[model samples]
Target: MPMSFYAQSTVQGTVTDAGTGQPIPGVNIIVQGTSNGSTTDFDGNYSITNVNNGDTLVFSYVGFVPQEIPFTGQGRINIVLQEDAAELEQVVVIGYGTTRKKDLTGSVALITAEDFNTGNNVTPENLVNGRVAGVTINTQGGPAGNSEIRIRGGASLNASNDPLIVVDGLPLNDPRDLSNGSRSILSTINPNDIESFSVLKDASAAAIYGNRGANGVIIITTKRGKKKLQVSLDSNTTVETLTDKVDVFSANEFRSFVQANFPDRVDLLGNANTDWQDEIYQDAFSANHNLSVSGSLLGDILPARVSIGRSDLEGLRKTSKFERTTSSVSLNPRLFNNHLKIDVNANLNFEKNRFAPGVEGAAIVFDPTQPVLDPASPYEGYFEYLNGSGFALNNVPRNPVAQLLQTRQIANVRRYFGNVKFDYQLHFFPDLRAVLNLGVDNSTTKRFEERSTQSATGFNASQGDF
Candidate 1:
């Protein structure tokens, strides 16, 4: 029994994309000229046990160039794969179908994930900023505000100029806010899950959409699984501050101007000088997180993505704050030898906003020489004007600071968007296919406002829901 002994070892390794440094899953790994084979997991990790030291392993994946390595008694071996340029040709998604880049006859622009804008972009429109020609993106309002995208300028004088948005084969209605026009629907979408964007600018390119395409058309396609399995996570945080402010007369400058211009009314100057603008402005913050997983099983591909985001913004004016929470999920599955495909996308968004009182407007017109608070007046401890007799002054807008602190307006909005699509190609004829799609968009909003009873406008409270 003093005989010979054979030693066995275990081999483990990871596969990654050389270009993007991302993991590649579902890759096939086999021992050369042997039946021993294994597949990588979602994390791009694979292991083979009971292997000899001199065994040669082969790594192969679709759309990528394969590589071979010898297991020189090492426990771990990592490999990088290069993409096959020939297999990476451009693919365009049109109104009702898809076409290769060389087959397109109309003027169209394609934007892939690699071309998206970097940073904390809350809306999909922001992702395309300064990336496309003849297209403009304008952000309205403050930090958590929505963006307005214009393609080739205005298309109509009396009608809406917004382009039609189509997501994963389903057309979305205009995301306009009829009441007060303060909100936009595109703000609910998660930009991290977008795979590509197709813009139809010319009349010939948008003719397929008919009347809705007059303004333009944008088709959004989300990510899906390939021949490999992959898992990825992304997160970031941001801090925001006022970039520039309007130049206003300082306390001493205003006093000097008033004394020189209105010598007779010099007594109108208050004892204290305050900068109303500085009293209201504050800082804001935001954070975002995203996770995605995709792989293949039993000759079928499954891809899923989820994202969670939150933003808290403080406006330059006091009591002006906006908070929003967004979440979304996308799932895609392929079955029946690639003949059956199903895609489901769902999103949920919630927003809360507290608008400043007349303070923001009054800060510009209110007397800068006036004191922020009065001690002996009837409205003690509150910013106000009073006469020598200890009575409240009249015929003037309420103190900007008092208006900001005493009045309250709160708005809450909840929105949900979901869609499901199915496609089946006939086994007899691969060219012919049948499709079914269903979708829904729903939103609810509630607003509450209240004014103090001691204010000049008296007590007032109102609530609305839609």
Candidate 2:
């Protein structure tokens, strides 16, 4: 055996983002086989003393890939780290505890932030749309509208197909009905705030959640503060248009066919022309913005993160829209020689929505020759076929656009979800650990729906606030 002695020297370096080239503060740098270590500051600079040429330097950060570089008498070494997709997905968060995927068995699926769908994924369910193998995301209408998420399909017809949603150890309700304009309970959560998703598909994998896991279990872990202080902004705008307009006759096309086929019946048609499908649909725009700040608090003793996000989603239907504001805070701290870990996370969400019921089917069958509006006609200036008793005719269809606009359903919802967990490893047995978790989920829903007296669906008017 040959033994060699290497002189110890101080090493200094900067850590930067691989893609953005931005300075990354709070990265941990440690020399292998030694306690000698240091953390980068706000400028992404770190100086570690007593590093030998034979020693290996390890650089690690949350979200970014870890790196190990062997010291070869270099005084300074700058490093760039790419975002690590496996940082969140490779480690599993479940009822028992965090376990690596390679060590876990049963029908389990993982999806990290990197695996999320691109474009305007405003809702939580939309993030996993086509990514998971057995999970099916069924969206109704358009963005911000109701959605159905089924894990390996439904187990029973009587119960809901929604999987049990556990966010940071807090269980929450999912979309169930049309009461809320945006029926989804998870609508308040910002998709950008999500770190990863673990789906327990099989009975054995979901057994930890008990009966609630019968449908399946979806574990959602939100992002926590990184080792370094970091600021990030995510903004995106999406435009949606009717790709192929029903493939039906337009106002002009219907008029020509009506005249060529039945000249005598043309007398019953009105002079004004309208395309029902075109009138009901519109070029929609959706916008999402998220800003987050994360770093160490109290001299690195506590890692804290704060995030704010807003989403404005416009449905293809002219009358439907959803707006939401979301804010969250997370703190994780280690104590007692890294044996005790405490985690606290909280989220607040507010939403305002105008739900659009299914009226697209009616748009196709409605007459294209009729006008959308008439001054003399009732129903809020929308043309309505009335019977002798001054009621909207049962046989004749109402304007699809009017059906959406005249009957208004507005919902304002607010939700707060929070959780705190404490885990302590036994000093006697390093592998043994004791854990305690507490969580709360609270929500308030307010709705106002009205059908004007003159509208086709309205024989009486109904309204409320608060």
Name the best candidate (by lDDT): 2
* Model 2 per-residue lDDT tens digits across residues 104-212: 7777888888888887778887888889888898776766656777889888978766788899887786546656444576778888899999898988888878888
Q: What is the C-alpha RMSD of each candidate to the true structure, in Å?
A: 15.2, 14.6
- The TM-score leader among the candidates is 2
Per-residue lDDT for 74-155 in model 1, tens only? Answer: 9998999998765446888888577766567887788888889988787788888899888888987664566677899997
Ten contiguous residues minimizing lDDT sum, candidate 1: 457-466
Against the true structure, candidate 1 has what lDDT? 0.75
Please list the C-alpha lDDT of all candidates, in the order they appear.
0.75, 0.83
Off by over 4 Å in 1: 1-88, 178-182, 225-231, 291-301, 357-360, 376-380, 386-395, 457-466
In candidate 1, residue 433 scores what lDDT? 91
